[model samples]
Target chain A: MRGDVQMRTMESSYSTKEVTKVPGWHGLVAWDLLFNNLTTGLFLFAAVGELALPGLLAPVAKAAYPVALVFLLTDLMLLVLDLGDPLRFHHMLRVFKPSSPMSLGTWSLTAYSLPLTLIVAIEAAQALNLLPAGSIVLEWVRKLAVVVGFLPAFGSLAYKGVLFSTSSQPGWKDARWLGGFVANSALMLGCAEMLAMSVLSGHSKAAASLRTVLMLLLLLNIIPAGLLFAEFHNTLSRLYRERQVYLALVLPFVGGTLIPLILLLVGDSAPGILGAVSLILLGSLAIRSLIIKIPHASREK
Target chain B: MVIRELELAGLPQASDPPIGPLSALLRRLTWPFRRGRAPQPHPATGFYTDTTVCIGCKACEVACKQWNQLAADGLNWSGNSYDNTAELSATSWRHVKFIEQFAANGRPTYPDHADSGAPSREVTLDQLLSGGGADRWLMMSDVCKHCVAAPCQHACPTGAIIYNEFANVYIQRDICNGCSYCIAACPFGVITRSDFDGHSHKCTLCYDRQRDGLVPACAKACPTASIQFGPVDELRDRARKRIEELHARGVPEAYLYGDEPGETYSELHSFYLLIDRPAIYGLPEAPFNPWLHLIGDYMRTIVSGLATVAAILAVLFLQGS
Candidate 1:
């Protein structure tokens, strides 16, 4: 019976001939996800950092909020660039669809942008001494930005995972753990970026703390990633069976995940940590692209 | 050969591209599709493509292209039999996929239909060694399934992909931002992004013609009546009777695909009658809509996401101060 099934499947060439790739969301979507998580990670890091390690993190995070805002704008820009007819971009805001993950994510991005901009504005004003640092009004505004920012942060953070998982793509379907996976990925990438930032500015003490956190994240990220891979094993394993796909993905794993992981584990050198951070960023971006690409791009005719 | 040599030498190979400014302008001027009768309302309709009777004429394919005025998929030979157009795409909306699994000359490279999941009808080596009619050529004039619960509709963040009154899944090109979300959302691989224009395209199920109370170009042009278009309910009934007739005629393998709703994937507005499993035609044995896990996916995110946040906090707390 199994052989018969195989024969029919082989005869049909069903695996090879189906609509191969997603029409357009390939390279740009990857960038969008990266930047999305990058922005989210920075903010989330600061949010947790303020409470967890107030002395070391509070001032730096305050400094990084502007950078996170920039990363977020780029993410939104990439989202616009990914559109088929970008001129018709305004149509996205015409509806408030809860059923569609993409719709919800877009709205979340929009919702989050306002508070994010305000947070940056407040930070910038205080930095430039436009507003008195201890003024009651500015403090209230800052608090408001943080409060208004909460729900949308959680919503935006998980939307991409749901967006990818709740699609008809073979590898993506039924992977309910994807939303959490996105969160984990964001944290991993965020920590890497922070470690890199600390090393660059010669904040060895800050780097030490960030390094430990990043190492822990890299270790634990395996759980959700492992589960996702197990869920996606059937599709991914099949894709990996193809020589071209195997070649395409191996680099991201080795350079992105493996090498950096080793460097972080053993090395305390600033340059080594920076190299690990850069490689992880590249590898992470590549892996995200591949995740989207593996299903959307057709290797076979 | 010269282009390859030049490319290998890292020299600019000046090959005249297929799509250049001159050709594009010429195509625009010579656009030949007739603007059919002014649009009007029609009932919910669909195509019942019976692959058993398809003769691979490709008249439907040509008619579809002519009526739609879609660009030719170029002169490249697929080297995969007469299926030069390949699968349905932004340009080639109606495609005839030719699955030629015939025995080469006299030797059978595949198993005989003995184990085809039906009644016991086994073939022996005696029959196989001899020149037997081991020809199992399948031709499906493929088009959009236009699913009842179209995943593309759910995936379209812009709400550009919608179900018309005819229940045909339609993409409003004007509103579409071409996010390609719908392209990924489709299980059948029907939607595609056009190279000419970045926007994704697929069969509109002849929405314009249907509105004008006319049968779609492909079904109308099918000489063998293999592609039948009519009200979906009536078509479903006809399909049932036809399948029964095929089964009674000793073709027990015949079955309807996407004719009914499954656990996750819903019914297809446009369906097919196949003599073999759907996989034989590059279709999944059981295609699922990712939207089925909509709530579950979000719920899982809450659990996983919160836990990760807590982990981040714990990690920071331990290392900080």
Candidate 2:
């Protein structure tokens, strides 16, 4: 998108001063951004479930699993649909090391998920009362699920950094800086789900707290995103590429960061909360997409 | 006193051997950056790709395949240029890029001079070599820069890739899970995932050869000594002299690629001598790691976090009112 902005857009949203202001984009833009986050979060969550429970809850897990599985699986299919082979995937795991994120993620998935499967198994067992309700195993499994389930949940949330931080690409490698990006993104994404649940359940403080966390994350991503842009520009010191970074990273910071921040600060009503929540979700999606789309060359010498 | 002395006589003390195999293994696994009392500082291994003497021979490509036992590319052309193996791929770790420029000076060689004029001298490579000429051809052999601050290394969650004592980037074959972050992180567009095996592959700087006191296979194979392999300092000195010689002979465009001393890297190990802009040879002029800008992103997150906290507080207050 930033690349396309460079190629297509003629208007100067980016300026050459210490402070360059950008015009606001429309509602559709924000809507599109939120949609992407919702989609990614929901999809990744489902993948976590599949790897966690394969057969124990057969019909329910089977019927419901594909909803998330199909979405998660489709992205890979899309990558291959563009006239590329998909069979080469197995090689990703053949000689796996613990140092690589993909390797770690694969292992993390395996470790976090096996227990999740057990949880489902235990749940099925409980539903069937195959074991007594007061049995030690049943009590232990329930306790374990509450504790262990968060592994895959939180792991899925935080794994984006592992993917981005490892890229030798200019946009992804800022290992020191990306923690907030991932944290805020995950927090907001999680908060949005909680917010939707809140709205459905009645505007409870839990939902409100989630919205508050989401807004905080959205605003939190902005300042450093700006500073990072300045640093990125200073580092690159090239017009052609720096312009692209500014457009993708900084432009969204306004609609995604500032506007939403302003809305939150000025209005504390339900509409205001919804508006801010919606914007942060949107901005996060754009940021994530931009992070992924940019191409960078290797820096290791 | 005599009895005490006898008791301690021959029995080895618990702390007698602190530097045993277990300790040694523990140190190596844990102290990645520490260089304690050791034999010589590890050999500073690196690649020296001297593009000046290159004849555009694809022998390096062939040798890489033979040594790595890579799958054949089956001779397909992209038709856009003379390039057969279009770009770097998962399988092909080494690729020679070909750029065809009609104007040798990289722009309209003679802005006003065109076909409207009478018969122009056929400016060929031989003629340009013979005497002063306006047009010239540029050829560069591209490979991984083997960056000192490799984002790929920093980003590897599993620690699959690491820099050797010699500072050569190494990917442990047993560990790489083929995330392709290295492939994407590489600014030089060098690293690629092998289609056959998914794991990311790139020039090892011939780490294996350097370990055995030999030059990289590509550098060794170059008949013209085009790819000089040696200590980076010595190579830099030689490269400087060669550039000076080219300048003395009036090839003003001759400059070293990836050799800026104070740049992001402390003078690239696999730096090149180029007769064109780095970008013309497909290098980012002022490349940077995105991680550097993360500080700003962190700030933004903090501000955003505060705002979130404040907003929640404000909402709670409003509800109370």
Candidate 3:
């Protein structure tokens, strides 16, 4: 009986055709990446600027900080809305698993928000004269906020890249350079945001300084973005061949890198600077969306 | 009034019965308060799916759906051979794959090598039934691997995906925040988000049945004993013996997948005995663990961040001087 069963089932077969499956990540995830990078990027830029050149760029840093906080809050709301069970989001903070990027991100976001909120509140109080001017205690608190905020801001900025690189999707896994790419892009976006704020507020000196900073950041961003594109080209030629990939490259190169570089070279004018900043911001979002689209694009025929 | 009083006099009053010493002892031993210690972990159990014996009946699939109370994935032909349901999804936990290959005059038609001067050969119905050619059909029922170090568990922000006492990966639906991180993390592409509820869903490895000392519905319903359920170690040994038997009988391609911890992750509790390369069955040849490659990436990010800070400080100092 066993022999009969074995014989009946032992047929050999061969199939040379391979099957490719699409990734499950959707549009919400793409939006999450965009918001996360933007929020963290702006805060880090402002905090670093304030810490590094406290006296020279105080007004720009102060203006950028509150704006960054608003974006951060919006990003948090977006994250919650993205959850399938939004009510159970608290479970994310209930446990901390060092091995899990998602867990780390949740804790980092929560920790980062605390100092950020304090900085925003204190700055607002000082601006409104609720806190006495030139108080040593207020100065100390401000210094402490900057120190406490920097670590989490930096972690939050890079966590999205780590999250993407850790996924099993072939397009995402092969592009390990994405972490650095995202971090640099975040910095560029932050700089562009500050530039926009300075230009709009008619802070000419601040705007010029921001323009120079934005140019340097934009140039730095190209290194990682170019490396990521090259890696994608080598590993996922099919996706690299798609029109969307070219668009992704061009949007960042022309809008983010080239146009911004040209505008900075031509000297800072209010309108021209505004145009470049707006383009960089749009390019930042487009590039992130494209990164999310790569794996899905590869799944097509 | 006199008749009612007479009838009442004939009735006896009810009283509580005394508890026996044995009954009292039993009650004390089984008391909820006394059972406060953590439940002992169940032995690791798993399914050993021997794909060589599957007959494409889809009995396992039906049984799993019925037992789990899963909704039908609709009857839509996918035009991919006899695979109507296609790949595994949120609603369809068990998927039976049918791979039909044809040969003419004992030579296989190489469709993949169409441009390489390989002749296109077709086998008719009569030729296949008469067994004059090398035509054959391969059927395998696919399910979640229930990996020891499950990436879904690692990727879950809410710790919703966890290892049960039976050593199976389980997703706690109530705890899941629907971040879909696990969907990306899963190398096997097993887990999927439900359209209606938006939470990730995958095979739970029949934890409830295992706790009740019963075999999973799929294993119980398998007609040819292709899906065998037992202790993972025992299943591994059985799979090894079966592979050896197949080798001795001239079937050399038989091998076990996810039976041992490779470079990617850990051993899978539910593994497979496959005759073809893993990719043929839609499995990655070399799976990667995200956690494994994270440290180097983190270090690089830290170093680059520090370098940027230093550069900024130097620029500031130069400007000031």
Candidate 4:
């Protein structure tokens, strides 16, 4: 039942009556569902946000395509392991259930990911001028790509928090802040992309605009996290109680939220510039790290 | 201990067929466990583990494995302790915990002892490694307590898991969506998702056996009568008497695990009478339900719902403007 150690990043304990038996194989199915929803959901949301507001972004949003496609492939591979036939993944698509997180997540990924992939391919083709720009078809495709790419990225990012929140686990049940966490994480991620593109494009007006978005994002991300930490501390559950809270709350808050917020507020001076980018990047890393280590019931021995 | 099995007047007494209206009225008031009657907590269920009488036979383990038909897990030696099977798992439902500690100060080997033992004969490092005079070796077969207010059932998302008519937590495999919410919610880390089926599973308190009017496999196979099972009320009295006897015999640490109704989960149906602090056996010092987090969940859900609506409305208003 220790599904994986990933579930137990925080300390917790409880007493219950243990059931001795059931008729079947070991519980691989549950692990698959959890892992798939988590991994795919994260990618979908990240992709959506990146694609949604490209004109306002630095160096455009072309690179997010390749990043998202890679995640799409990773998710597909993970999905293949969940069934007897990987080809039958389309079966999940035959019907849709809005109330079902998995169904919603699966359909969202399928719907958003394919168009986004095509858009990225077209963008790449145009960037290299492989597609003749004067052609009406090419122009139309570019316009469509620009319009359609944000849905999956935002959807994927936001769905995971909802998915986790709806779960019966006491730890997850209180996670109303999780949706905001995902949104903030997406903004942080978006900022990182903007920063990279700005550096590549040099100090243009676009770069300055990118900096503005990044700065605004820094604020958007920090406040909710501080609130989350305050709320997590208030939890009466045994799992939430810790003598000195570590990775799950404090580390993510400090490394991911506070540091970046501080840097962005200081207005991108030399140290601030370097620190802002690094802290934002580090924050994303911490966000993902906290996600992996946040202790589910399965991890406890 | 009073057994006042109230015999109320009812219709259809064998001696007198076709009973009257007064008999029916009397019978209606007799059944205390019926609807509209306030439930006095069923005389607090508990376990009377006579560890001193335990032979460490491990029949309980075998019985559990056979009844549950759990796959053999971690067959290889773990080297952490004598427990190659390490701890409880989705595959291994019953675990036998072996604790090695000092038994000096003439402390009785019982779970009730709030204080850990005083230092026994201190051996040199070499002697200690050689297993020289290792004072106390505690063997406990740990299982779920069937807590009065079971946390796992409360935490399950798909409603796949539930407390049955027997008041034991049972997982309905078909309904489980494999969300693993119950896994994180369980404070004890007792309920786990089986890696194979993708559904959470745990000890059922031998629901099948209970229906057949038989004890759980562990209790039935306990050669030393260490893992006794039955009506919880009767068990508590037996545990109290045994603890008193142990104290008289100079074993002061003979306390009960999950037995107290107030400090812990109200009462443990499968509660244990132990001879040492719970921590020594990997039990929490004090365990409480995680349901209290629901208040936060409720407030946050409402606030977030309002916030989302406000954000959407603001966007719409701005677009109109």
Candidate 5:
């Protein structure tokens, strides 16, 4: 009996070596994040530019509006497809549970999408002479669009980070600063997007102003990005030690921030500006994908 | 005088008569609608899995599948260990994990005799199989923890995962949209989506049996009584007593996992008794609830948004000046 007891104790100490192999929120989920950030970022840039620098940047904002609208629709489709039952997607909206980040997100998307669609429709009508340009009614509609689109745009931008942060996975949960990081990334990407659009459309004055705004956004982004790195180093040192850290964190820092800043300092050529914007976009996607790939390190063993 | 004596003898007693079976059944059927009567709470039921006496018979697994009508997972061997089923899934609610231990020197870790003081014990696998040697085999039956404060419940967007009448976390099949958020939120990694149905599934704790006032099939079929089922409070008491008894008998490494609420989530309704650290059993020692960290994350996001606004304003101001 004593030998039996000892054997049982020893056996309990042996490792089960069971690793959960479920593919969590990959493929379309990552694409959804990219498209979501792009939509929110672009809409925000357009709305703010239209309000602040109407004379200089209004045309650039108008050009970005339809593209942002298309991206938003794509994101919504991707979100539904990722669900196990796409037909039941409306069930998420039946109840409002603040405890659930996904519920908050669904509502945010709805709110953001409505005003955005109105803005795009009005813009399209104006371009086609369907609605008289500079009419007081059209001006009022644009102003209303700005008001309604403000909170939800930022909410949609930040909620993706909230969604990931609320996961039980250690790689995500411990990084409380991820929300700030993602929000800042969105802001940087938005400015870069507007800058690229203005440059490509031959609006040199608007492009120059957007370049300055992009530089300011990048400078501000460093705080949250640095905080994320510090938090990851302190909490998930094992992950910090892995090569994924270089790919996700270091590469993004260099390609997204450093290279873009250098390009802005150099003479404003179309290729240089476009290359810089493309690099930032690539860096953003890389970070999002990396976050998805890194599993919560299984407890100590 | 004769009439008065007859009347006294004819008087019957005033006691109520016994209820008939038909009337009892009628009363039961109508009990819910009876006015002003409060609903009675059912006793909280859960599993008390004691790993000490588990013999790896796999009877509980068989009984669970038979009772739940769960389909077979397949007969393929993993080539990893004696465990053929691998891990718990949507179909396999109950899984038996097998662990075989041997020292680096090819010697059995457990000595044949307790009197032997040396760490090295020479016992071959053949001798161990004969019940005369030092090899040790540990088998634990794993199931859904049924946490008191389930993250899956909080994370579910449609409220599909909820506590049933028996205080067990139940996934409402029809309501489940299969967002798979619960799968990510579950700290134990117990919940899984069925390939055929695309809905999340886990152990229901034999809720139907509990409704009928019967023990779960796995607990009932366990030959060694390793998988004990009863009221949670009673099971907790029994588990404590058993732990003490084991300690007295020289097995001091015994401890409970998910038995009490700690830094992780709330106490688990169905917990375990184990002789090793939780990680050895493939359980997290310190599981974090994502909700716990939400406030800080949200605050940071708000602050970052403000900073972005500040940057934009600064750019505008610099250009204006």
Candidate 6:
């Protein structure tokens, strides 16, 4: 919707200080950022499922990796398609620049795919009964997912936030709470996904447990979210005063999070939990798809 | 290794080393580039724009466009004096800003483009006749700053943006994947992604012309020698002398912008001399590089991730209980 934002001519000389939107970093960039975070959330879910609740949520554990793998691969394809030269996306692998968050992100993204794929392979082999019941390969893959996979999954969660903050864009410059906010939101996103899966599989116990964790996460996420809002309080007040912005950002996020959080806190029924998780999922998607646009949107006038 | 081979009189041996047939074929194919002549080091070069002398004829802009073969922007009435080119873009690298400080009735005004849909230049006969409410009309030809530590270079993921031998920030056209990170990272709003090719582009400081032992096209075509091109050190020295001369001549308001190392950003290699603050010329007063906060950003990420890990562990413990 914001794609038509023009690099408009200076209306007046005095307006130059606050105007001039840099063209590029369009909607596709926002979509990529959102998908990358979602994929990492799935990775975190699978990693935790395998390590902590193998017996209780073993089926959900088995399903999470493949879903994560699919999401990750799709996100990678979207990222390449978002580039100016899709065919030369491999050029990102040419160097290892720690100073550049994008450089580090590209490398970490590639590294993350390996352990995820390995876990998916082990899951596939087990599904086909290609190995014995107590196979060492199965155990090793699960353990590796915890040890090796955690690093990149966490890296994925963090890198996008670092990437945004380490740019000259105005809304992003003061994003001290961005990493925490994204990680916490994605954690809630992960719980919502797992809750849906467990509830569908008729694991009321797992669903209840996931619901409790989601409640805690929902409360925890407020710290970073509130801080992030406060960080932009001075710079973004003018932009936020518009009715469209309030409707687009504030209404959905507040309603999505608060309503579900309240429901989870008081209610324990399957239908209620399912409905709440749905709201959480929608809330995260709504916010993420528009978050990266804030910096550019501020200069639209 | 190549130098040692040449010094030891083993150049032939280095080129045709004893190897398997497959290895030999690979070696032969790569030998030319491996033994290529080393490049000569050159001094860091950039422009020293003294806006006081700018006539706003836009000869440098035309020269830049012609030499770079950049696509022309369609004619659009800017309503901001004679600055019709508007701003720098993927195509228009050199933009001459015409700051019309005076308006009709001598209001000392930069009149807002009113609710009227059409853009208007508000000069009236009264102010012109009375010679009242007159303010300085500042004209500056702005280009890429080519900062000593370029934020765009640091933000490029593909290693496409690199400093050439002259220490000018050069974008490798073939290597850039048009990620557009460089666009957002440039504090001066210099780089822009082209809709035509989907690649971000800015002034190369005429790396091609400099390689051929020629001055940048803009500097060469400048009518008033406003855009001076030379070694950065030489330009700084000249700027200091010019500043002293201006102050002596009672033009005390004149000072250099981007000439000295800034608190938040490095000294701009392509610096400027202006009579007013940088904000008046549409330049940031204190442009900050993202590099300054890069470490803090990463630390926040790691700390957030660690907090997440702890949260996850706590949840797991609660479930077990």
The predicted structure with the larger TM-score, 3 or 4, is 3
Clashes of 2: 46
Docking class for candidate 3: incorrect
Please tell me which predicted candidate would have the highest TM-score against the true structure: 6
Candidate 2 regions off by >4 Å? A1-188, A198-301, B1-41, B79-81, B104-116, B119-129, B317-321
Arranged by lDDT with the best first, the candidates are 5, 6, 1, 3, 4, 2
Among the numbered candidates, top lDDT falls to 5
| TM of each candidate vs. truth | 0.82, 0.59, 0.86, 0.55, 0.85, 0.86
lDDT of 3 by residue, A198-268 (tens): 78887776676777677777777777777888877744556465675567677678976798789777977
The window of 10 residues in a row where model 5 chain B has the poorest summed lDDT is: B1-10
- Tens-digit lDDT track of model 5 for A60-146: 988887889899999999999988877677767766777788888888899999998998899889989999988998979887987
Q: DockQ order of candidates, best first?
A: 1, 6, 5, 3, 2, 4
Q: What is the model-wide C-alpha lDDT for candidate 4?
A: 0.54
Candidate 1 regions with alpha-carbon error over 4 angstroms: A1-16, A51-56, A174-176, A198-208, A241-273, A296-298, B1-43, B104-136, B318-321
Question: Model 1: which residue pairs collide?
Answer: A12-B280, A14-B282, A21-A296, A22-A296, A84-B177, A84-B178
Candidate 4 per-residue lDDT over residues A1-301, each given as its tens digit:
1111221221212122121221121234333323333333333323333344334431344554566566566656665554332333444453455444445566667776777678667767777899874678875775566456445544554454555554434434455676565555454455455455555645444445545555555665566566555545543234544643565666656776677667666675545655667766665555544433333322331
Tens-digit lDDT track of model 6 for B75-147: 7897878878988888889999988654333333322332232344565777445432324557899999999
Per-residue alpha-carbon lDDT of model 4 for B1-321, expressed as tens digits?
221111222234688666579986565434321234322332232345666666667787778878877766746775434566666666666677665553334443232231345333334566445433324556777777677776666544334565666666677653554545456545455665666655566777777877776788888898888887877777878888888998897666688776667653556777776765566566765766545444453345335433432442343233333
Worst 10 residues of 3 chain A by lDDT: A11-20
Off by over 4 Å in 6: A1-23, A131-133, A242-249, B1-38, B103-133
